[model samples]
Target: MKQIIEKKRTLGLLLVILGASFWGIGGTVAQRLFQQDNIAVEWLVSSRLLLAGILLIALYKITHRQASIFVIWRTKQTAFRQILFSLLGMLAVQYTYMMSIAIGNSAVATLLQYLAPLFIMAYYLLTRHSALTRQDGIAVTLTLVGTFLLLTNGSFSTLSVPFMAVFWGILSGLSLAFYSIYAVPLLQQFHSLLVVGWSMLIGGTVMSFFHQPWLIDLSTWTFSTVLYYLFIIIFGTMLAFWFYIASLRYLSPKEASLLGSLEPLTAVITSVWWLKISFGGYQFMGTLLILLMILYLTVFQKKQRER
Candidate 1:
């Protein structure tokens, strides 16, 4: 039984890492589309959310015909909470992260969003009044130093990007933090598919009023651009959510979110490897620091379980 549990958890962690990988790569691709094609951010966000939401919901309808997505919101209390989460957490995260990408580049946007774990840490401390462990303190310090190195590119005299990127990126981080913490109750009680699908649908529907994605013009887009857009919607948005949500079954929301540190590492590698962006020792060290923090958390959790 113990071995079986371990195997299941390993599977869950891999799925969450895969999901984060998609987000990282997808963000890079989306950044390319935005910069090269001048694609409208509002339209892309609205379309991605709606299309991904619909696809997941349709999948649920097919497999579990007995369980409607509406069952997630069967009670008034739940309905209200779900709507609030959809708007405040889901919608905000999607839009702000995309906006950060549009205003900046993927690596910076992604790294900034990793600040979500910090917010998660602060939240657990404040609400739970939990005392910090030695590992937590060291991890927090590493995360901060890693973030600073990334943004400054190891330089004290200059920032690597404009102020707008920093502003929007921090907002993206906050939104991500909120979603990771807030989605716990719903995720624990329902199928990950049901909760995520309905939340996406509701969030997309709300964003539609502000930006009518159907009115988008694709005349300037080529075959490759179209392919990238589809990939973002299907793989990055839809599959990513499904995998990450499913991981909640095996891991605490905070630990799962902490494991998401992999996304920025993925983004940085993609940026340098595929995009031919320049990189060097300092960035590598920063990446190492962040990875060490993740490693610390993983070991800490396992050790606690053993104890």
Candidate 2:
């Protein structure tokens, strides 16, 4: 029975990692589309969230065959908290990431974003929780090193880290950490889809106020642009979030954290294939180190459990 449970948990973690990998693909796609089309970043984010929220909500209703839409307005307190999480987690992180990219480069932005796990570890520590074990430390170190190499192009000194970019990236990381931590509690109280849907809706709605998506020139929407938007909404936001939440049901937070490191790796692969970006030998090695760290942590964790 214990073995069976462990197997199930492993499967769940795999699913979550797979979901995050798919989610990682969105950045490359977005960047490619953005370069080709004259689309504002704000508008792109706003549209993606709004469309994704609508689609997920619809999916939830169709699957359950119930009126979940009305649940959104059941209570002001619930509504407000949902919106708050959405803004802080989804909107804030997304916008901050974009801003970081603008201020620095994709590599820097990605490294900073991947630092969420570290921030999470720190959060736990601050709360008087046990510090991450050797495995966790190894995993975090490996990820950080991998991120640095991935971003620095193998020579840290060659790169000039922009202060603003770093700030935004750190902020993005914290936002994501907070989202993960806080979301766990919310998920316990509400269905994952419902919580996700409401959060997306609230986040999307708040972003719309600032982005004024209506101001976007509809004439700019081309066949390719529409396709790009569709991919972001469907694959990036909706499917990714769904899979991530599903994974949480079976995986420990530590396990999930380790798997989440794959995002940067996926991003790198996408960059190479989709974005036509290339890296040098050292850069590749750095990425490898990061992966190794994640593997070390995960395998060590399994070993510990067995003992």
Candidate 3:
């Protein structure tokens, strides 16, 4: 029984890590696409949510064999909150992240955006009535140090960061933090897929007015672009999200946050391989520090469970 449970935990961790890795690929693809067309950042963000939302809704209907578009009128209050969370947490974080990339470097944007874990820990401590452990504090400290290293371009010099970029990065982190905490209760109440799918649908619908998808030049779409877009929708949005929820079924919120720390590491590795980008010694050290912190938290949690 003990071995089986350990195996399940291992499997869940692996799924979350894999999902983060897939999510990591978005930066590289987005960079390539945006460089080619220089499309409005809002449009890019809105289009992704709108299209991905539609795809997810279709997928949910097919997989669940349920009626598409169940009337959610009675749950309007909760649904409204979900929509707000999705828009601010999902849509806003995504948009700000892209804006960070636009205004700063990809590596910097990624590292800064990952400050979500810190915000998540804080949220849990304050609102969830959870006790703050020493390990949690250490993990948060390490993550912050790693972020500082990345932001300073590995030189420990803060002079290079632009004012607006910093603002966007911080905002992105806050949004992600809020999402991580709030989404947990909502997920407990509804299927993760349903919550995510519906939130995406609502948020996407709201964004459509700004993105103006009807103006998209469908005729100009190349096979490669279409392939990239489909990859984002299916692997990035749907499958990765499903894996995330599955992991949450087995792990605590803090454990999930620790696992999610893999996202930035995966992004770094993917960027190196796919984009041939390299990091400096300090950057590598920072990444290692963050990974070590997450490992410590996971190991500590396991020890507590055993005791």
Model 2 misplaced regions, further than 4 Å: 67-80, 157-161
The per-prediction tally of clashing pairs is: 0, 0, 0
Full-model lDDT for every candidate: 0.79, 0.75, 0.70
Preferred candidate (TM-score higher): 1 or 2: 1
Candidate 2: TM-score? 0.90
RMSD of each: 2.2, 2.2, 2.8
Give me candidate 1's TM-score against the actual structure: 0.91
lDDT of 2: 0.75
- How many angstroms is residue 229 displaced in model 1 relative to the true structure, after the best TM-score fit? 0.7
lDDT of candidate 2 over 1-307, digit per residue (tens): 8799788777776777776787778877777766788667788778777878778777788888855665745888766777777888777877888788777877778878877888888888889676767767777777778777866677756446789988998898888777777667566656777777777777788888888767777786788878877887888778777777667667755556557767777878888886788877777887788678756755766787788
Using lDDT as the measure, which candidate wins?
1
Better of 2 and 3 by TM-score: 2
| Deviation (Å) of 221 in candidate 3 | 4.3
Ordering by lDDT: 1, 2, 3
Per-residue lDDT of candidate 3, residues 1-307 (tens digit): 9888888888778777777767777656767677765556666677777777777667767887855345433488776777777787677767787788788766567667777777777776778777787877787788777655643446645435677787888788787676666677676666666667776666667877767756776676788888877787777766666676557766665666656666676666676788787767876887778777767766877898799
